[model samples]
Target: MDTKSLLIDTATTLFQQKGYKSVGLTEILKACNVTKGALYHHFPNGKEELLITCLHGLNEVITTDIKAIFSRHLSTKDAILSMIDKLILNFEKNDTIIGYTFSSIVSEMATMSEPVRIACSALYENIQNLYHEKLLTEGYSNESASAIALLLTASIEGAIMLCITQNSATPLKTIATLLPSILEVNK
Candidate 1:
């Protein structure tokens, strides 16, 4: 891989594991075996720039995957169920239901960093919009659909956190089963 890509990937892994404020530039340099000059040559703003790059990379992964899953013209309920299943599959594959790169960082740094906060917030809004659009297409009123979409997003994030803390997918599974009921779907 190229230097920029290598740096971003290494930084993403480190930040995901250790968080944005906790991880340092020196560690990233050492991990990538690149000198400070080389790092600055690629990212002039140092750690912040790298962190932003990582955030953007993760945002693309999230938005793209979500859009792909949501593009199917299923009913609102079915679309949500499919999205939940996608989350479960992702968590299972990675052996981690928590520690999501962007979510974790947003929670950590949003209070302090304007740029990071804006990026994270925009990402979340985009996802919520996608959900709302799907709901509207399924015949729900706009106001109710947007609210439900936001609730589902918040619930899924909370569920992921709970599952990670307990080191089990039971909570996630429970949420998946309960989601349809909460959404007032007969299925």
Candidate 2:
């Protein structure tokens, strides 16, 4: 909508398709149809700042979706399954996933830039917190909920990485099938 938002959205998509290291400010500028002045005005620190902002924007959307999905499902397992199903459908339709791309960005930038690393860590923590809250609502103890949340996050992220690396969604689908039993959400 606005120039800043447009830049972030464009950068997010580009950085997802191409790693942050490979994508230049010029590509973002051209894609967003904005000049360097507009980008610098919104992101004074340059491309890294833009990457951080893009991560923030992406995390915001994910958090909102998690809330909405959790609210609608009424069961933690159902909510998680629905989220996984959505991921499967997205990959089946688009044949690409932003999570895989973001994983790449995190792996590459985690050692190079503190801000980028923090942004990725915060994004992960936010997702884990969302899952933790859901587990709490399902009557798990605080410790149990926290651990389950972390496990779920790691499993899903690992499945996505494996899916991308192996060029098959079977890993994700397998995890989706096994999650209900592994999570013991019904208990």
Task: Identify the candidate with maximal lDDT.
Answer: 2
Prediction 1 global C-alpha lDDT: 0.79
In order, candidate lDDTs are: 0.79, 0.86
- Cα lDDT tens digits, model 2, 1-187, are 9999899888888888878889999889999888999999999999999999888887888899889989999888899899888887777777776543478788889999999999999999999999999888888889888888998999988877777778787878998889899678534
- 31-50 per-residue lDDT for model 1 (tens digits): 99999998999999888888
Q: Model 1: how far is 183 from its true place, Å?
A: 2.5
Model 2 regions more than 4 Å off: 98-101, 185-187
Candidate 2 has which clashing residue pairs, if any?
A: none
Cα error, candidate 2, residue 89 (Å)? 0.4
Model 2 local distance difference test score: 0.86
| TM-score winner | 2
lDDT of 1 at 28: 94
